[model samples]
Target chain A: MDKEFFRETLSYKIITFLKDQIAEKVDLTVYIFKILVKVIKDILNLRVGMKHILNQAARFGVDSLPLALIIVGVSGMIIALQVTSEMVKQGAVDYIGTLISLVIVREIAPIMGSFAIISMVGSSMAAEIATMKVTEQVDAISVSGVDPVTYLITPRVVAGFFIMPSVIVVATFVGLFGGYFPVHNIADIGLSSYLDSVWLGLYEKDIWVELLKAAVFGTLISLVCASIGYKARGGAIDVGVATTNAVVYSFIVIVITDFLISYAFFY
Target chain B: MIKFEHVSKKYDDKVVLNDLSFTVDAGETLAIVGFSGTGKSTALKIISGLVEPDLGSVHLDSRNMSMVFQYSALFDSLNIYENVAFAFHERDDLKNKYTESQIMQIVSEKLRLVGLQNIEDLMPSELSGGMQKRVSFARAIVTNPKIILYDEPTAGLDPVSSTVIEDYIIRLKEELKAASIVVTHQMSTIKRTADRVIMLYEGKIVWQGTPAELLEAKDPYAHQFVYAKREGPMKTTAEAR
Candidate 1:
């Protein structure tokens, strides 16, 4: 293998893979329809005929409870301190609830909640499929009569996709209380005005928009991570490589897509 | 009964099986004896449906089949019971045919049949090579498949393990009344297990007969192969065939 030959071969493989994928591209219109159907089916599977969304609520319960205590707890204290110090001079610290709502609901909740899950779930999925690939378990699945797509990918993607919005909702609630500690008595922000600021941010459009963002972020994380896991190669070392790649890629996609979607929201 | 009809397989233009055809009848063990790279495993893969034939069909006459691969094909994650119950996991038909408890019970019975009782929860990594081979056998028989394909069952085992494997193969045929196709390079294994021997050379069946016929063979390839001689057909084929 001369350097030039190696370079050509590697490029050839990459090009070939891309070409194959392009040729085999599933219908985008059909894929969206399929995903909607899957989401509906998932909802039905969780519990039938419940007015409240079990998928979303269960996701919130599973994802946000502990996250609320730890990551958001610290962030909440820092946010309260930062906002109170800045706004007290202007004597507008009463509006800390409003500002925090804007940042948490619009950005931080969506990013932080989903990003953490991606690190936890994405790597595990990758390690799982990678081991199956290394040991021929996936091949066994195929030979035996089950499609790997339905058995392995569907539940995780569905669970992960819906879970983020729920988690973000929990994060937003946690952050609101987090802002309360330093401000209620220390910063001289009145409780009545703070409640008003929090309640006013609860517009129907804002809630829906936040939800759309959470869903997009969740889907992207699960899709990228599951895709990486399903196609994982090499051995034990490869699992680690895949895990790192999945986390990095999921975070990057979340940030970029979030920015793009946010820009579209206003533009 | 399994039959390979004019089967040819190739990878990157190097022909592995070239117009190879053979038949396996009911209740008989056909041992395919050949050196490595002579396409023995490739042939086994074709029959097992793990690898598709490029130029032919592996006609099963609709007979159900299973395989114990040369290497331990047991799932590392699955315990001994689940590993043996693998055939059930493959098909929706198997799902309908056997309940989970029934599948597990059958797996335990098959494990014991292979002399691996009380170890159904052991992982594949815990087992030695020969034990793994026995578990693979358990997997093949768990379904009561009519045709079982063993790809080099005794390749890396010590003499004791090898003999155990051979006896288990015999017991499986006698007790389960299933046809078996054993592919190996071990002449002793062929003598011990094969009722009929097929010698493959350059991706084709050059010789096939009973072990008695193999002993009486005048064909240089058969003679050289049976005696493990480095002086004849296999040697010449490796050099220039």
Candidate 2:
């Protein structure tokens, strides 16, 4: 009777829920770290295939380029549209390019580009691996004496690390152009003034920081998604669940890491 | 040779296999027959090292073992040639030994051994289910494995297709002279491919004998299984659940 009463209490339920959530998070973190360590070891040993790495790089970087550019570009345009007229009214027309370029380079482009990638490439990677897990392709690979981590996850993580910075570089340029269109048409700013403002406001450190953030975000997204997918069991429904978790977890990790990196560099 | 000694496995609170012991000599095929969820596939996985038993040991004379999964489990991203040649390309001991041209020749020969010819460029998705199973067979023997495990090799196939797969199972056994385990409930599969049979229930083997003894024996479980009777000592997965 005492046990039943305790179980019926709201506090008990809440505690149980918290415990379950914490356990799951801990498990996920451990799995991700294990995969990261294996991937690093495989990379150091040159166990990862170059062909597989290039193939994944093409998929993650080249294939995701157009969508990433469009997302970042639209975000840049929206920011410029909302701020340009107001800044001009305050006699701050010269600062429009500076503010817009600063935001685009330091924050907007990397985040939005990663968001696009998490949706497209990361989710697909999760689903593909989850399907393999369910169908026993992963087991077959293991039985064949090949490490699934080296065969499947290493190439993807390596590709993400190397290719994402390139994607961000292109997205950053496109975002600048996107902001320029809105600023020119709405605030009647000259190209030379806007260019001068952008030139003055942006520093070399910002570009390097952006690239660093992109590389980190890319690696985290791939690793987290693949780890989640590798943990999938059961059947088709579990595959779907794994894919959704991959996307959600990648988004959360990227956001938190972005804040931490930004705080460390600029604070 | 393959040996399983005092193996036990459980998932969460449910026991799947309990104190199971078995052996298959080199060049012999053993069939594990049971209803779904009785640990037939689990036994195969335990032998292949895909699943670790909770308590016991699996002894294999050689480390070279291959598992042909129920659904073929071919890598969708690769063509038929790549799929068959996967071990040569991926396995550490074999990857550096074979040149690309040598791999191509071995893959072609293996595919032809399974009665498939010149379809190496097609993807797994393009093949029929039976053809995919054959390709998986080709892949399984590509490494010249000493122990081969098949999880429902004839499952989800038409009668003709099932016969074809059974034929290949016997043929591969003859060719490789390897110890083999086939997990299945199909009577035809047991009779045609399995040299000896074991019937599992409630995490234990309830009966074992040659295929002839399996058919003629009056053991309640084997009787129920061979006749497909609704009333018997054995329970269906739904009833067990």
Candidate 3:
């Protein structure tokens, strides 16, 4: 081998191979980062888009409200018991009320509420957009004297962000009560501390945190779900794949972001 | 009326359609024909604004248009009635738009027109392939569209379903007096529904004429495509036709 090619003492072949690996790794990082940025940008756009979907979906309010309530109630009951059990074992049973309050109001309720919304509204958004995408319904909307963003995205993102907070607020109360009932019915924890430890010491920041989390979580959920549907290609199978990816990505982002946000808030 | 002026479309540097120009007169049917990848659907999509043309402008005077997808674009979460009603429910700044009752009536009428009135309560899942197509068609027409674009309306359907969809297209032309644009691989659909036919090949409109003219065109690509032959200038997977 020429000195120019071999003088580095690393074989040219191995060096070239390493270079290729780095290039691939860099490309993958960019791709993943692009997706993450898209998710973030769409979430930011949610302030407007989600409102429209919520307004439209709300017209059939008789259907959407009860659906929201049932999901909130069920998730609340299950989460309250499980988390309190863990806290109890740590000799932190008294903190159970406070911890439950934080989890439900600040994190669990918002995330799960967004989950329920995604299951109902997010999936629908994907199916709608995917169907529109393949069938050209979205195209129809675009050509018909209207911008698809205003017609589609604006409404959906709006609905997601707006409705999420409302649903989360309700879900938070339900989740705390979910914990309260178990603490009363099963743990036999008295009502005095439950009320005092949970509701009595409520800080303005806690409320702010809850609302902020709800709003952000809600907006993110819609943005991620609708954008996934918006970018989806191929046929029904592609839609299915997009839906799955949207859910998995949104949940993963939510968990990571929630932890990070919580750390920033408390630490 | 809609016009495509020297339109070209590319995806990731792969030119799917190139340098095509055509016009659809107000309230007229224009059928596009081509072998797959000759960019027939892409042409339709270009005009419909589903896919932007990389190098042309599609101009239309009418602001209200609808597309009937080959697979039907009904929302799965919606029942048949809501799916049909979505056109009316869509928010727009237009004045004197279809009222809710008016929209419902139109939905019922379109459902009746498509022979799917009995299944208004069904979700998209509950409908058969043919029924789904019918529901999709109703949703399109329920908007009272000035232009209706159909992408492979008869694709993957039984002859009976094909004829049903074709008949509805013809009826929409005669009764609703709507302009129709159809892209299809099914020659029978073209023959039955298209008032005028255009063929795309290698991104160009290789042929354009009435149905009779299309049937008699001596162009090798048109002949290969309309006749569903695997021989001639049209490229197949394993060979050129």
Candidate 4:
């Protein structure tokens, strides 16, 4: 009788916890969906100012450049080194460039580039909007009859959506170059042979696929961060908390989205 | 002119405002006084549409209304000049409204009116608390709004700073000629700025009178609140209901 009671109590707790989590997730999804709708409406109405868009683009593209390059470059070199070392043991060293090119183009470059953007640009966006909320700057804009979403959010989303794919293209190239260094020296592949392998491994479909992933990842990062930040209340500490949540949630969503997109396209 | 009719608001069943009704005509200042958590700030928020009343309605014929927050809610990213000129810059729909030079002139004049000078480049973080509040004042009046709401504008200020703010309230009352509502706990502010006073107790207006009449009101709640007495009809629990 005691064991049965305990089991029933534990099951009840678990069910209640699950229900709460689902409710929280649904709330977050609805919030992000509302922001997405506002962004779309602002775009259609031409509510976004070009100057703000350019400023945000510069922030996402220019400020994010060094981090994207460093991460993708290091990841590319590490992948090439690890893969080439194994290929040497198997006497399949000639295929080092082909394997590195395929992995870098299809996965590593886009993911690492997105991580850089989510950490650098998305976190800053969240912190900024969160600070605005706590300071009542968001309220000030609203009371002025200005749509805070249009004035504050739409530009960043549009900039991220448009610029991230270009950043990813650059990251992919830098990553390939990084891979080239290890393969050419350690695996003794000539530059021309490496180029030929890369060419053979990359399909035109992969380019479009990677671009689409970047776009989706970029939109998710900005929308999640901005929405969370804008909705935040209380004081300065809340701003910091919102920013941390933005980073964590953005990274999780980006990875999940990448998986979904890959499955849809590749499956 | 603005009016709140039969407005009721609650935060999770604890009533903040209950069946409250009030109005402020143009060119008048209405002061709302209450103890902390008595919905003074919430009432202002409801009028500004920052918050919604759970029941009843708010009628505002004027579209141009501004609220000066207790903490002065200035945009931290923008410096003092830009913060004050924000609304002016946003009026792009008005053809031949004002040139950049004219806007700058007006911003300078407003800043000067708030007793700030030559610090337009300074960010909100760099300013003292009092200065930030004054900057918020400049921003609020720069648009020449028809209805202005001051939420604890004198909160966290020194005596002198409070006087300066009161002076602005009086001066701008005549200068801008806008309807103003001040939510504050300070009786001095009520005496100096208010033409009509409403005392909130237990989410309802327990007393309504002019500032002079406030001191002589016979209600236990009003007596206890105005004199800051430790014990009175202002119960600490819901048992009063």
Maximum-DockQ candidate: 2
The lDDT of model 3 is 0.72
Ranking by DockQ: 2, 4, 3, 1
**TM-score of predicted chain A against the true chain A, for each candidate:** 0.74, 0.94, 0.72, 0.92
Q: What's the lDDT for all of these models?
A: 0.73, 0.93, 0.72, 0.88
Top candidate when judged by TM-score against the true structure: 2
Residue A31 in model 3: lDDT: 50
Q: Give stretches of model 2 more than 4 Å off.
A: A1-15
For all the candidates, what are their Cα RMSDs to the real structure?
6.4, 2.3, 6.5, 2.2
Model 4, position A162: C-alpha lDDT score:
91
Q: What is the TM-score of each candidate against the true structure?
A: 0.73, 0.96, 0.73, 0.94
**Recovered share of real interface contacts in candidate 2:** 0.88
To one decimal, what is the Cα RMSD in angstroms of model 4 from the true structure? 2.2
Return the lDDT, model 2, position A101: 90
Worst 10 residues of 4 chain A by lDDT: A92-101
For model 4, how does the per-residue alpha-carbon lDDT over B19-58 read when each residue is reduced to its tens digit?
9999998889999997777888889889988898999999
Instruction: Enumerate the chain B TM-scores of all models.
Output: 0.92, 0.98, 0.92, 0.94
On lDDT, who's better, 1 or 4? 4
Error of 3 at A198 (Å): 4.1
lDDT of 2 by residue, A69-138 (tens): 9999999899999989999899998899899999999999999999999998999999999999998899
lDDT, residue A229, candidate 2: 93
Report how far residue B209 has shifted in candidate 3, in Å.
Answer: 3.4
Which wins on TM-score, candidate 2 or candidate 4?
A: 2
